[model samples]
Target: MASVSNPILVTGEPYTPGLTREAVCETYGVLVDEIAKLGSAENPLGPSPKALIAIAAAMGLTEQYPSWTAEPLRKAIAARYDVAPDEVVCGTGETEVISFIIRAYAGVGDKILMYRPCFPIYHLFAENEGRVPVYVDMGREMDFRVDAYVEALKSEPIRIAFLTNPHSPSGKLMAEADIRRICEAAGDALVVMDEAYIHFTETEGSLHLVKEFPNLIVLRTFSKAFGLAGLRAGFGIAAPEIIRPLWNIKPTWNMGHMQMAGAAAALTDHEHIRRTVDLIVEMRGYIAQRMSGLTAFRMVPGSRSNFFLIEVMDDRLDSTIVFEKLLERGVIIKDGSVSFRGLDKRFLRSDVGSKVNMDRLADALAAIEQSL
Candidate 1:
């Protein structure tokens, strides 16, 4: 018998996440409370209290399978977004839904349009499926490359175009009007808008675009504001025609019982969501204020999202070096160079943490500056 060959793996830079407290403890022997995790844009307030309770309640039903369709959670999400329940599709997370959208629409060798330095997963999944990723560079300044994107949509045989709203690792939000313009030009292609961090901003985002654009698929996640990252809860909003194919590709019981129940409970806890968003918004201001006072670093301006990128002002300072130093001091921030495309090693991306945590980070930076 002939030996089987190994499965082909997609090649690219793997997402380098912030260090967990446990990993830090093992490496540097620091306690969990000593660490301020400002990476991955998690809710600073942590998971929703109602979600915790619901998850606990769901533990009793572990032996049974989750609802095949997750109808209750879908209904809750539909109500929140003002779309029909059938127009929504629940998944383990927004990433899974994105995979479904990409696979459902684009096939092997089909062109998929993406802005450089986008949510890397979008490119990752497309490449994994053997789809060609056509890039429109965001250029040197990381400005929104709307003209480039529109040109690609019109010129290429693009099936899927992924846009990250309040874009990750930088936090620049693409306005809804601009998104509408892209949708109008996309012709036959599906425009996937990943709004995982949309709750961080005050605006409603491009969910409304789905109503007017049949090819628009809006993805939202509970991982950000709902603080349900560990549970892996999220949904997609699209017309029933678009959603039907996604449902066909999704595995039965893709979402666990606890995740669905926790997500549903989280949806009802609007006050908790409000608090989480308000805290991030408030700290975004606080962090920017703190950065202004620092001679060593400055934040990248114009981010309306919860987290923003910080560039070390000093020519000699490297963000990866600062990242290691901060990790030793129990503060974990993402080294921006490794996380996204087109970023140099001088920058770091961090979400707003609690007051005490932020203070510790400030102190850590100060100490590093003194040493330099």
Candidate 2:
């Protein structure tokens, strides 16, 4: 067969996920257990016990199909959020939900607005769908300003806007007031707040805002605090008016039997959620304190999520080199440059791990400072 290509299939640069255990072990010739596994912002303590039990029960149903619409799970999520079941919609993951939002609401040449250096998927999906990607640059300081976002929304003929709360990579938690301001100014455009890490913060999240902002959509995932990354479960919350269109386009049986089972069980595991959040917040504070003292690095402030960024202050040391040195010591973190837009300077992003694992990172950074 002859090779062929199509312009329609083209996309922006591919996403770079954090280092996996297998890759790190193979590259560094170390045991998988030796790596801190902090790169991806996964739950360090592990998956919810209830989710594990539910998966085992659902495993026997491999031959059967999932219940279309994931009705029961949707009700469970709705009950938790105190919203109607119809207001909730599930996806394979939040990313899929995001793509659905783009495809359902945006057409070719329609502008999909987001902050520069925000989640990469927003732009990548917009481009793949032939929609225009509109970025409002987050200045060199990368401050979280709702005014800048509101101005962009007011000025542009935007069809959809995706903003992250407790934003990824930088981990800046958006205050409810700021969120409210943006939503109010959004006018007729749909406001999508991707709160994939909101559980890690004190902010009740933009969930409450959805009740007032008919154009609002809040996206949540089970990957972090719920420790269900492998399950790929996510859902969206919005008024029926905003959700109806997404439902019209989403395929039936989009989620699987096991995913429904595990997610439904995980949602009820409040003890697990409490413990995970507590541990992460504790460790995050400890590491942030230690990381700040390192003269070579400056810890970015206002991080309410599980992960935070550290800028390399020394001109001699680049973030890419720091990532490699940490990997050599069996510590894995994401290089900040590839993580978000407007991050032109050298920086590194790390997630909260257990005390022992975090200590390993602290020691590695101390050594890296002297050598650098």
Candidate 3:
């Protein structure tokens, strides 16, 4: 018999998402509303009010197809970033855009550079397309070393390189200067700056870098700060030359009417965005301070995004133990032992949630510590 599927995908690991709120409810007998849901870095305050209104209003358009280009959403994104509409290419989500870039630029066996313990989509997409994923170590503490990355870029022929600003899992924000050095070293290779969580940080981010480096592409999403994750609306910005190919190859009407409408309205909701950022900032500090006294584990310092990592210090309790214990208390988070590639049992990633959610997590951890 002939082979029926791509061998790489047949053998490769699929991306593993965090446990859902309903899953916790089923397994632990917790109420659906009682779950803290600190696992998937969702907006603690929920979707923007304006976005919800827009989505409801656009419900009538469900029978008709959406714009082939997602023009309105693209224009809103362009105006927000000071980029041209033609320079933007919309997708169902940033993951779709990532797949598009991998498919368009890299051929089979081509090398795609990325940091170890990344978002996992980068590696998974490359493998799905039969491209090689080359990883640079993020160090034991998940620190980004520009020199090491630059060296890797120049080491061989790399077709594309993915850098996550305010990197995932760790949430450490890389400096602009360091990103510039990497772009300079990339030369002809395409550099993708995944800025999904950039809104959580104070920095202006690398959107401007797209103008400076023609080979650079900056990916943005309404999922994180804009609170439109369920809509799956995201776009990429780059030189018109790079975006043109992506636009041509992308599926027509990739974004639905509600996604386009909701995302566009969410972009204009500055107050909602501001409140979301303020909440993340406040709860992050609150949880950090609350967890400071725990002797079993310590919060990993220097995260500028909505989530941060907690490393279990006591040898008896690994990330798995802590993760299961938290689930028993209705506090859910990412267990590094299974979710992240390079991290071990000592680490877990927790999203900064509302005061109530953070309190649940802190209290759960304190109880676990007391038992230990």
In terms of lDDT, which candidate is strongest?
3
What is the C-alpha lDDT profile of model 1 across 1-372, one tens digit per residue? 553331235344455666788888788877887888887778888889999999999999999987788887888788877889999998998988988988899988899998887777887777777788888877555678898899889988899988988877678888777898899999889998999988887888888888899999989999988998889988999999999998899997898889988999998898998998888888888877877878888788878787888888887789888888988998888887787766788788887878887888888888888887
> Candidate 3's residue-wise lDDT over 1-372, tens digit each?
777457976788988898998999999999989999988898988899999999999999999988898998899899988999999999998989998999999989999999998999999889888999999989777899778899999997999999998999899999898999999999999999999999899778999888899999999998989888888989999999999989878888798989999999999999999999999999888989998989998999989999999999999899998999999999999999889888889999999989999899999999999997
* Cα lDDT for residue 294, candidate 1: 80
Candidate 3 local accuracy as lDDT? 0.92
lDDT of 1 at 257: 82
Task: Note the clash tally of each candidate.
Answer: 0, 1, 0
Work out the TM-score per prediction. 0.94, 0.95, 0.98
Stretches off by above 4 angstroms in model 2 are 1-8
| Model 2: per-residue Cα lDDT over 1-372, one tens digit each | 553342445534667788898898998987897888888889987899999999899899989887778887898999989999989889988988998899898888899888877878898778777898888776555667668788889898999988998887678877788888888888888899999999999567878888899989999999988999989999999998888777778887898888988999999999999999999889888888888778888778878889888788889889888888999999998887876655665888888889988888888888889886
Q: What's model 2's lDDT at 311?
A: 83
Worst 10-residue stretch by lDDT in candidate 3? 1-10
Error of 2 at 317 (Å): 0.8
Assess the local accuracy of residue 315 in candidate 3 as a C-alpha lDDT between 0 and 100: 94
